[model samples]
Target: MGYLLITGGTGLLGRYLLRDLMDRQQKLAVLVRPSRRQSPHARVESLMQSWEKICDRSLPRPIVLTGDICTPDLGLSPTEIKWVVENCDSMLHNAASLSFVSTGRDAEPWRSNVDGTKNVLEFCDQARIRNFHHVSTAYVAGCRTGLCKEDELDVGQEFANPYEESKVEAEKLVRSCSFFDTTTFFRPGIIVGDSESGLTFTYHNFYAMLQIAWTLKQSLTAHLEPDGRTNVSYFRLLADGTERKNLVPVDWVSEAMATIIADESLHGKTYHLTPRTPVTTKLMCDVIQEVLNLYGIQFDPVPADVSTMSDDEKLFYHHMQVYESYWKDDPEYDLTNITAALPNLPCPHVDSAMLANMARVAIAGRFNWRDPRVAADVNLGVPEEVNQPNVVKNPS
Candidate 1:
């Protein structure tokens, strides 16, 4: 069997994909960038060890190709290029920069999502690799409030952040490429922890709300009177607690992607890996209040100006401004393609119990706080700046 080459194999989705594919005894190779203190090979080995502990079994190691996605030819050496050309039959492009805010015109999300994709395409063209799988995000629908279909790429809609804009550009590039005989695009929604154990390596998106709620709870609790009552009536949010959020478990996403990848007949199609029953903002707030022991929390529409708001409200909104869009309503995703492909594989419903479990795990993990073992297990090849603190900062 020819080796299946993968990029971002050390990332959250990539690690799960590696586990699923390796379990099938498929030959594999991963393109990884060297870190500040560890080589590419060392990074892959560390990830594999973590996977072994998670799965409770030994897994076959993948061939590690030291390279950078931002550079031409992925910065691969002459011998490494030859190895890929001779042994690799297909490629899975899963690496991406997850920065929501853009630092500059040509920085971060743009460099990795747009430029990195171009480089990967160029390399694939030279290597004569036809079959390709690209992982994208469903948020590429942007600020559109209606139903988003799998067949749609650009709808002339406004993007909430640079990350969404970059992914849209990248997907456009892949769709336009003519050299690839088979191109499959997998667009996943807000990916959270595993459904069963609520275990994840990183925290953002929905988890950001949890982080904020936890911080707010601690802050308010500090001033509680002897009867456990404070002057603060209710914590305000920018949403009315009825907006829907499409949150799919990371395991489900990986499984669905892997299943689609293994079937050659399913190529040349776009799949929106989203949940059928979305979790509501009210449910989220309820769970957060329960988990963090924060009562009297209320969600409401964001005011035009916060100049006249109370000190606590201003402080809370100031810190949560970066994630304001996430709290708003999300578009309805069309999952026709995925539904037909995996008719029997239903997306798990994210209920109150499930949210509680995820919250428990996240709190226990301290929102993936820096630990030597966690670092070794969850490096996504991005810089330290991209891994910003998950907490919402309080204004002085």
Candidate 2:
């Protein structure tokens, strides 16, 4: 069997995909960028160890290639490039920037998502890799409401942030590339922790809200009397608690994508690895209240101006400004392609119970801020401490 080249093998979904592919005894090559404290090989080894612990079984190791996606030829040496071209027949491009705010035209989200994808495509073209798997996001539908079909790429819609816009551009680049005879796009919804264990390395997006809720609980508890109930009025935009947020477990996405990739007939199609029934904003709020033990939590419309808002409301908004777009209703994602491919495969329901479990895990892990695995070396462009939550790091 020809080796498969995977990028972002250390990321949330990438880790799961690595495990699945390894379990199938597939030979793999992973392109990993060197971190500040560890080499590319070390990072892949650490993640493999974590997976072994999670599964209680040894996994086949992947060949780690030291490279940067934003650079030409993936910053690969002539020997490394030749080795990949000789050994690899398929490429899974999964690395991307998750920053919501754009620093500039040449900075993150744009640099990594757009430029990095172009570089990967160039490498694939040069290497003569015919099969390509592009990991994308369901939010590529952008600000469009209603159902988003699997085949649609650009709908002339506005994006909530630069991240969405960048992904759309990346997908377009992949589609327009003519070197690959078979290309598959896997678009997943908001990916959280594992469904069973709730284990996750990074905490942003949905988890960011949980972190803010934890912060609010901490701040309010410090000010409250010993037996006083913590009551706070939360500010929400014009949402009436009916907006739906599609959340999928990381494991499901990886498994589904792996299954699709293994089947040669399933190539050359876009699949939405999304939930059948999306969780509502109201249900999420109720679960948060239950998990954090907050009483008298009320959601009010965001004022026209921040000048009249209370300090607590202002702090909450400021902390969650980056994810404000997620608070809005998500467009319906059509999963007909996925369902037709695997009729028996069903996406686990992300109900209130699951949300509670995820919240508990986040609270226990402290949003992975102090975890040794994550603390070893934070991803590029992510700060050690984020005073303002207007930026998202390592988005899935």
Candidate 3:
């Protein structure tokens, strides 16, 4: 059967991408690493079961094969490579490692994010895949902090961490891989949870800050210092005034990407999938406060200053910095091509309240926050950024 070959088929966006194709009557054959040992369907089945509580279960299933992008020709045997060449009509390269901190000296990011692209390209050449779709983070534009065009790359700006650097390089790989008849890249800014439920598959996401706050609320997390203003705080810098964060829900991301790839003319175009009305850090923090209050957690707001955190806490705080700027300070994206392609499809637009509702679902047990370890799966994970409001505990 002709297939839509997808890399990272079981990832956050890959699941949505596969489902979109299936919805259009497209067969999916995703590439999996041989190390998985088990059949690809079984692996995805296990993973989906684990994430079912977190990720939306509306996606369709697909065929899977053990393949690794890190290896030559994606580590596929000559026969397997030829199979794709003749059977797969299009490919979506969505697998990438987003480790911002491990850039300079760490080699894994480059090997997987950059060289992985090279290997995939070689395989595509061998397979002569008809079309290629790549899912790249909008951060690839780097620290330009201004309007970024869909066609632009190598914007003159410094990157915050290795993850950004690696994405930049990986994108370069996709751009140069012009062997396919058509190539398209979709760059999304700081993806959060589902727009409807604020659902997310990965724990490492926009709510990372809230998780930090909840952790610190369990004890002193860190001291936040003043940096600038954001709307949620009413433009009032937090007690420890610092830059506010930017966040976008995941539903918009997956749905928008699904919409973008449907157009054949959009094959070589780049589309920036971002919110029409942006949310600020202060508003994001406010929603965190409400979620905590919803679950009866308490704490006091303190400006977070990494310099003041204990050695162990400092390590955690450092990770927080990776996603901090990306969400709050978004990169400019051109969406004209996408709007032109799908006129009725709603763009991935979101704001603080929409984000808050999603957070509520995540904390309120609409999907299962109970990890089997936490005494109360019912607890709303929030830190004391605002005055601790008195409340009751989870019933169960």
Candidate 4:
């Protein structure tokens, strides 16, 4: 009678995970923090209603527990704690801070990534949930080149940012917990939109470049020629165009992780949810140029001096400074674990056309630039707009 307890049920991949698992009729419960505008149960209802709109059917809802992962005992009441102890046997830790840098020890990347994970582990120990699943990023390999196998973690490699460093510590903490019967790790690469629909609830990583290109295109309108191509100043990127980045779709990652979790035989091993063949930077730039009708984004083998750069070039670098390390070539990810577990479900190849489609969708949606749509007063009866999953603002 015990159910699987999931954290981060409102995140990008978390939404898809809920949908995929619910489709399989697996008993589930979610731990969600109340937002400023909505209670915990209201947020879960909104998420479920959004998924129902997507599938065009009614789906069973999971019990919602109101709690903040960073708080002591996960901010759960005594009764709620008792419910978890009595009704939950396993857990999936998906909540995390995605900030690339750390402002301070109490600030992001550490607060949510490290401290929050410690709290979750404490709660798990108290609740006695034996099976633990942690969602880690493949970038935990951190600035490492060559082949990064599934079993590899902390090889004295340098990190590109604080986010990677925090996640590595969190994974180590989970592994250090001695009471767990099974420990599983899911490390996914740069996650993009859905393969079939090209729809994404969250926009980061690849979308960052596309958004910059779109803004650049708008800024240099007079430079545009009759052929609709802009004769803008070329911005020199740090890397050559040949570097490849491992990008994977969200749906594929969710499905693969769900499959492994449902089968107890696949527990206790790390799974790399990465693409077989990664996409090159040149191809991504080409797709952006073709979709946005903009050009002059050239790559240089060596770094260019900032003083010698043009105004437009400087502007590009200024905006892209945070994500500078992300554009580097990724290592060949060993998919031995995922490949064997889900032979029939293969990772979708992200070709130029697919990238183009995703770029267009992001551009058309205005890169999810909008005000907070969820109001303080929410009607529980799913409204017409609430029925549309795309319009449902993510609380995370």
The candidate scoring highest on lDDT is: 4
Whole-model lDDT values for every prediction: 0.83, 0.82, 0.62, 0.84
TM-score-sorted candidate list, best first: 4, 2, 1, 3
lDDT (10s digit) by residue, model 4, range 1-396: 368889998888998898888777777888889877778777877777777777789998887787889998888766567667767899999999899977888999899989999999988988889999999999999989999999989999999999999999999999899999999999999999888778787888889888887887787444777998876556567778898888898999999988888999999999999999999988988888789777777887676788987787788888888888888888889999989989999999999988888888888888883323344445332223323333212111
Comparing 1 and 4 by TM-score, which wins? 4
Model 4 TM: 0.91
TM-scores for all candidates?
0.89, 0.90, 0.76, 0.91
Q: What is the lDDT of residue 121 in candidate 2?
A: 92
- Candidate 2: the clashing residue pairs are none
Q: Give the per-residue lDDT digits (tens) of candidate 1, residues 105-143.
A: 589989999999999998998887889999999999989
Instruction: State which candidate, 3 or 4, has the greater TM-score.
Output: 4
lDDT of 3 by residue, 111-181 (tens): 78988988887777767786888888777767776677878889577876677778888888877776778
What is candidate 1's TM-score against the reference? 0.89
RMSD of 2: 8.1
Candidate 3: segments with Cα more than 4 A from true spot? 34-39, 47-60, 103-106, 220-246, 294-328, 364-396
Clashes of 3: 26
